[model samples]
Target: MFELSRRNFLSQGAAGVSTAMLTSLTRGDAPVSEKKYAVVDEVAFRGQTRRLKLMQGDRYMAALIFPTDYPTHFRLKPELYPVCTPSGVPVTDTHQYCFIHHQSIMTGHGKVHVDGTDHAVDFYRQLPYPNTERIDKFHKTHNLFQMGPSGIQKIVKADWKVTDQIQLRLILDWQLRDKESSGGKSVISEQRRYKLFQRGPYTIIDQFTQLSPHSQSLTLKADRHSLMGVRVNDLIDPDDGGMMHDSEKRKNPDGNYWDISGNRKAPRWIDCTGRIGNQTAGIALFSHPNNTRNEFYSRGWGLMILSPTLGHDVRVTKDKPLQFAARFVAHDGALAGKTADELSDEFAAVDYRKMFETEK
Candidate 1:
């Protein structure tokens, strides 16, 4: 064999290393040669027949599923809202349905009816506002509203991904029937589009910029005029209005509700700021302009609620579709806006497409 010099030996070694890396990169199913990022696995909860997955990547992100089934709905309280004291003894309760996190609040046992009537359902918890005394006020529903079979099918395309930012897309479709009212019987059919983006660990840039092109042409028929509003509640205080002073209300009289202010003919958009567990969360609500009622916002720190009706007496006719879209973006710190005027301006500038389209 020919003797090799030290330089030649080193050159050969470098060539071998480069070849190996090239091969690994070109291989279709090669084992990972480098450290891989974390991946989330599928998890199942009570009342969820199908398993849901939590995904996290360069950024921490998760989708909290809330189902419409009564068993699952009632189970959410203790499972997700357990009392955790930073310094004191952790409270424990054997009761299946208890608001132990907010010990001062009363717990009622009942089911949410089809007519949108829910007994023993705390509106404060379900639709809370600022200065509310109820503790654990910001508790979210177990899942988004139950969309039934057809509605669920439409959302198959809906999912979320997180990279340096968070992106969420949801498609909701449903047929509304009017069985309660007689006058102005008609059908309202439409589709809603929602998108959100996030930057940094806690800063969220949200957008509710699109509606189905077909939505503007559709007229939603409701027995009574229906409007969509946001509901916000604080979860850290007692269950009643104990901490709210009359002066506080006068100082910030908005009452945590923000109406979707825009043209009633095209898709209407609203932007608001709130807090989630000390972390600020941005919200964007979108609806078609032809919707019978204007969009309303029930917005508050620790809680955010969106209602399509004011008196809860609204009814949708057959063949009509009632659709709404919402986006939640976690921010790095408390939001900068102090009033709706300031908040709306900040929301208007957020570029939704860039937030969702950027690769992590």
Candidate 2:
């Protein structure tokens, strides 16, 4: 055997070690795995009284304690319409107008305004002109800044389960109260409907549902002699403006009255895109049968708006409680249609007796 020199042996060892280190460095950083859930507890926002908690689990998620207080300086402002898209692009600019009330969650703190007020108006104000009278005149009837009943109680959770396919469930408790108007001739009925929104790796999804069964279905019934506004492609022509004046009316002449074009009236229903976990989701709105104007819908890719007017006429009747119910769901395109249909069925099955049961 040939003997190796001390310097030769040391130099060879050093070279081998350097090569190994270089190889390791060139491999880059290790990949990070996605978390199954995320939890946000007691997140204090600018204008809210209650401490909000958000939880994300493997198959279930929740938002607890939504605030009911509103601030006095609140003014409605414009916000981006159709906040989400099936193409996975979010609307970043506000092009539409809605009320923005202010409030603080915890007491003794100066009032802080939040965007949730604007969101609430944008999400709900979609009825056609004549039908949308109530919401348009909301301020004249009641103070926007005062604290109302707690809309959401305890834990509000949404769950998703995967079998051969994916399924979703939303659970919550809500309250309703009637506030006397200054005129005393009429009363403004307050109903707190639950709103749900989800944004993930896929696209965007927004949905709303009534937490109580006491809510009425969305239905419409105008006076017998009252004119039933002509619908041109998902819009109602309250003014009877001919199709030549409106482009949307020209597109779908045979569509429902609520679908007509040139009709500035808010829509009864809306369909928009929602995103989740590298998948695009579809969102739809449904109403209960007891509603006066049976609900109608607007289907599209970005945001869907459902009008409260679509459920009933806004004539204030003393002691006649105005009831409403709604449901929202997020699903892949494949299940959007089926999910919407099922939600409609569920709304129809709701009864007054079932509405009062305490949720477990």
lDDT of 2: 0.29
Residue by residue across 51-125, what tens digits does model 1's lDDT show?
A: 222222222232323222234433211111111111111111122233222211011111211332232122112
- Candidate lDDT values, in order: 0.28, 0.29
TM-score per prediction, in order, is 0.38, 0.37
lDDT of 2 at 256: 30
Worst 10 residues of 2 by lDDT: 103-112
Q: Which stretches of model 1 miss by more than 4 angstroms?
A: 1-60, 64-164, 173-196, 200-234, 237-333, 338-343, 349-360
